[model samples]
Target: MKPPQLTPAALAQIRTLGSVLRVSLEPGGGCGTAYAFALAAQPGDLTHDLGSVTLALSPEVARVLTGARLDYGARLKPPRFRVLAHPNTPHRCACNRSFGVPFPGRVTPECRAYQPMLWNLPECP
Candidate 1:
């Protein structure tokens, strides 16, 4: 699978780091799942070499992050890193931390929270 594309700003965010970016995901608040970032590497992690920095995506995390991009916004208050919108996650929640439908084993409440209309109608919520 293609790795998450890192924008210029995202690359800069870890320019000074000696460790790789450890990518993971966890259940979000009634809204699918969310990306979790760290600075480390682990065994069996799916790694993507991005020249300046490496992204070590956990087995589960890699699954949900398909077609995503990493970016950094310096102008926002407190200045932070964020994921750019992508076709695979059109139902991204308002919090900007969650997206898509919740993982299986989880139910529709998570999916419905971001896209209530999807469940009620023929379109995706």
Candidate 2:
């Protein structure tokens, strides 16, 4: 898979600052998945070198983030990292904090088993 696409500004920010960036799959509302960006890297994470900066992602998130784009929003009040939807994934949840993984798409086991009846979501086939 192609490495994640980072805007030039984001690329420079991390490389110049020598920052460690981590992306992970967090448990979301209704047992969905949410993307999280942080400065801490956890054990068992897979790392990718982006020039002087390192990008770490958990195994579950790595599967979903391939081919996704990461851009820095410097204009936002506090500035933030943004990610576009991966090609194979569809719409996000109604709350906008979680995402739906279509059939055949990979998801963490927690998502498949988390209070399934409450969300009216079917278990993976």
Candidate 3:
């Protein structure tokens, strides 16, 4: 499936971070019933080079993520990534998993499992 388009802001942010962002949507479960989304930061070869950044979504989530916009804000205590649904697509994850919610808040095990891997980067902090 074709990856969803990124918002201008998201594209700019990715560029500013000197990283490439990719979306992965793989089929899941029986009849592709289950789905999940994960954000990953690639391993950097050099200390200064920016690594790859990716968002992996289960096949079922591809539709929900389509046209969704990602935003960054420092207003929060620790800052965070926010997902804004497109007007034409307002669907949430059917698995009841929350992707970009604040840390320490309720999150699915699947999402939480990838947090360490996602945020494990020198540039993340």
Report the CA-based lDDT of candidate 2 relative to the real structure: 0.63
Considering every candidate listed, which one attains the maximal TM-score?
Answer: 1
Residue 83, model 2: lDDT of 75
Q: Cα miss at 46, model 3 (Å)?
A: 26
For model 3, residues 1-125, the per-residue Cα lDDT tens digits are 33445555665666666455433323332222122223443342111222344444433334445566555544655554445553322223443223332222223444322222222112212
lDDT of 1 by residue, 1-125 (tens): 77788888888887756648887766665476667778898787899888879989887656556787888788978777677855555677677777764455443364454542232211212
On a 0 to 100 scale, what is the lDDT of residue 87 in model 3? Answer: 31
| Pairs of residues at least 3 apart in sequence or in different chains that clash in candidate 2 | none
Report clash pairs, candidate 3.
none
TM-score of each: 0.74, 0.67, 0.36
Among residues 3 or more apart in sequence or in different chains, the pairs in candidate 1 whose N, CA or C atoms overlap within 3 Å are 115-125, 118-125
Compared with the true structure, model 3 gives a TM-score of: 0.36
How far does residue 78 in candidate 3 sit from its true spot (Å)? 2.6
Worst 10 residues of 1 by lDDT: 116-125
Point out where model 3 deviates above 4 Å: 22-60, 86-125
Local distance difference test values of all predictions, in order? 0.68, 0.63, 0.38
Which digits, one per residue and each the tens of the lDDT, describe model 2 over residues 63-109? Answer: 67778877777886677776754653455655444666432244444
